[model samples]
Target: MASHRKPRGRSAGIRTTPAVGITTAALTSVALLSQSAQAAPAAPTAPSAPVEPSLDEVKKKVDDLYHQAGVATQRYNSAKEKTEKQRKKVDRLLDGVARRADKLNEARQELGSFAAAQYRTGAASETATMMLANDPQGYFDQNHLADRLTSRQKKAVDEYQAEQASATKQRTKAAKSLKTLSESRDDLRTSKRTVQRKLGEARALLSELTAEEKARLAAIERKKEREAKRKAEELAREQAAEAERKRKAEEAAQKEREKEREKERGGGQGSSGPDTGSGPGPGAEPGSGATKAAKVIGFAEAQIGKPYVWGATGPDSYDCSGLTQDAWKAAGISLPRTTWDQVKVGTTVKTADAAPGDLVFFYDDISHVGIYIGDGKMIHAPKPGANVRVESIYYMPIHSVVRPA
Candidate 1:
């Protein structure tokens, strides 16, 4: 669902951070942005080849390519998930078909035995019915043996026909499923190729730069991260102020209610009733489902240093959605495999209201996702060559927030 990220806008009523792929070069190994991290600078160019893009241009191109690759990776994840399900379905169907075929064969054998018994009793003229009929169905029908057939023999005929029909139906279904499975596999391959191509293009662009240019790009990424931090801090401050206002409002309401309760009780000094919704009681979790959020975040945090691998759902490495999906899975929630689907599961929340364990999606396309760990930050698997890490939720433009728990 993700697309080209538009130029950033200044802070508004609510805010989110950058997507993982947006400034991925900052921490990647060797961090070249033809795509990921920085290297050094480029050698002087000859006058004729003015077509070469400037450093910033290269950075933008590389970043765009990586973002595109991230999108492709989601497609791969989708197809991979579909293919797996289809494969299982196909297996079940094939197994059923095999069993039905066996039954059908047994019915045919039983029918043949009935025909042979009749032939031995001088019931039919064809020599074909004397032995097990290789093509006996035609011979039996032509001889009009139904009037002579016993109920058991008739039942065998009906069962043979029914099994044949059922087997045929199931075989067709299995074939359709297999065809779909093959198509899904093709789609998976296409998505994988697209991801590879995008990353390859980004790396090619980065390779053109000299060591110093690469270093400059890395520096820019570092600044980007710093800016992200600053934005997060600013958001945190604003959130704190908002929380304070809400607190004061609740306190005033409580006091006013107490006054009304006092008047009702003839000003007697006694407990009115236990507070209901003024704030969390002692030892209460920050929000409902906070305990589940903690488990999701805890699982995410433990994988912080693992490398990012597209389409991976893992103990070793993970893609952005892969990490989130697995984190929630650890908490006993089964999430759809792609970012697009992941965003659709839980209740949508305002960015400011996002709690720990909520899914934070990024970009208009909904291409990236992270597990919100609160404090205006989220933990995500950045792009290729980058490790799973924590960054401001505003690291990329937030598409929406979801409480996946």
Candidate 2:
């Protein structure tokens, strides 16, 4: 068997994104492709059926499913990375085992030659002749050293034994690596099925909503956006105030420096002396960070409107971290592949302190992330059915802010 362990299962909410392929993932990909909180709706219910969930309940349910799918997407990314790395290692191991097998075969051939040479000498039993060298006492023991193992037979036996051991060791390692590689692939596939299942459920939910309910759902989303804008404006005010305070402190410090310089000048023509320092100027690093940030922002902007593919990292589509990682790559900085790791890379800062190009993570679980485009907004891939677009950071629960360079 390629693998001994079996595969596992998945859950749901939305299915609008073609990336999930609502029709495809319900089976085949995963027999345990877990149906989300509920089984897919059968034929539309009769007039006397139990009342359907309210639009608001349906909206919340859809959001929850998408959130689960987003988390699954990150898992998929992690598993994919693992699968790729394991594949490379497995390849290397298989090649080494093959080489060891070749060496073992050569050793066997050399042993055969030794047996044939003995047979040419008109030996009674070739097996016994070879065994005489392997088991000395069986033939004649040390007393008949001349009749026992020739140095050539002894060497051939040793070489064969050594080659056999090496090949066995290599085979064991290759098997272990192959097993790990299989497990990683299974993990990747399971994550994918989980995402697809959740998306399918969400699609099913939406499919059942009445036209008026869908419109009402849109209205609810708009209200959320408006609320987000209000929160963003408040954050902007706080940032502006903080900036002014910083400016005042700098002004005071400058006045103090000027006074001290005057004291040094006494009563004569005074000049502002150069502040001599070592290494690259203080502005050098920040200037570089700003430049990189510009590149990152620019790259993200260019990607707006692209579909939100679960694990995509590309010019055409992206998941949250994929988009950020790709954008930073454009700016010449390497970011981790998943939001969990990406959050750990850059310095953490306040939302008010966030600048364009910072990563704004969401949910306490830290499952979602987006590039902060300032003004309390971020450019993110959003959810499955959505596209890469600019949205209010307040649209989701705030986790923490990170300034990924």
Candidate 3:
């Protein structure tokens, strides 16, 4: 009975198993294929957005470089002018030395003629030699003088020749210096152009990025601009407050001065006594010289309506250095052309020690100079796109004080 049951069960299982196995395998393959198709990532249909530079940033770069190049050009020109002037002086010296050498040669020639005359007179036979003799003593008696004269002339010629040689060497050196200066000027010009081109290229790069990048850059720039504007406004307010303070102080001082004058007048004749000491004059501090006070007054007087220039030292439109030079010139003191030199010429003074007419140098390397107008303030041509105005010294990096003459 067990054997019969086993055989029947086996038959039944075999009858159903082949078709079920085929169906299961087919379904499994279909599911695997579907999964494979879904799991394989497709190639990116579209590209990521293109990056771009900020237009405003590029423009700012252009302006900054342009301004810097302009300043460099002005400095180069100033140095070039100085070099050329030195060259001219050297040339004049060379010419003078050459003339001295020529004069010595002429003296030598005259002495040679005299000596030849003496030789002819002594020889006595040659008629041409006799005619060459200028001496009434037939040249023989004056032979010693002729010989001495020739020696002196030769010595003079040698000394003059040496001087001329030195001058020639100096002229060569000066010419080389001039050449170097000219080349430097050219290089500065070329550099200016290259920087300008770079700025333009940066601007051109602005178009390459996507809108998101552009927006990010714009946001950054806007934040920076807002900060700068806020700083500017704060500075303006500070300056206005300072000005107000100064005005109030001046008004109070004026009233006090008037009261003193009135009291002195009311005291009757000779009651005020001899004016022993000069008080601190207007816009001037005490413990300073009358000459300094006069200089300050002179600068203040000239400040009425002048046009500002970036780097000009001029008789008309003036820059920082120009105004200082002209102002000191009015005070009977001469100053160097550039701000750096001007700054170095004066005695260094602290802000507390700064006197009227003391030159106030600002910016690194002493590039900007102005007249100290008392109260830690100065009048100067500030920068490009700015005018000649009075401002606090705290607004800038002060270099030092410069005395005049």
Best by TM-score: 1
lDDT of 1: 0.85
lDDT of each: 0.85, 0.83, 0.61
User: C-alpha displacement of 235 in model 1, angstroms?
Assistant: 1.7
Write the number of the candidate with greater TM-score, choosing between 1 and 3.
Answer: 1
Error of 3 at 227 (Å): 11
User: Residue by residue across 1-405, what tens digits does model 1's lDDT show?
Assistant: 977888556763224445444456455634444453344667788678457778888888998998999999999999999999999999999999999999999987887787677678876634335234554456557766666677897688778878988999999999999999999999999999999999999888888899999899999898888988898888788778888998899889988887777777777557656344555664356544776788899999999999999989998999999999899888788999999999899799998877789999999999999998877899999899899999998878899999976
Q: Is candidate 1 or candidate 2 better by lDDT?
A: 1
| Top-down lDDT ranking | 1, 2, 3
Off by over 4 Å in 1: 1-47, 125-145, 269-287
**TM per candidate:** 0.80, 0.77, 0.51
Q: Please give the RMSD of candidate 1 to the true structure.
A: 25.3
True-vs-predicted CA distance for residue 328, candidate 1, Å? 1.0
By lDDT, who's the top model here? 1
* Candidate 2 lDDT tens digits, 130-214: 4536553344343453356678766766776777778889899989999999999999999999999999999999999889988
**Model 2 weakest 10-residue run by lDDT:** 7-16
Question: RMSD of each candidate?
Answer: 25.3, 24.7, 11.3
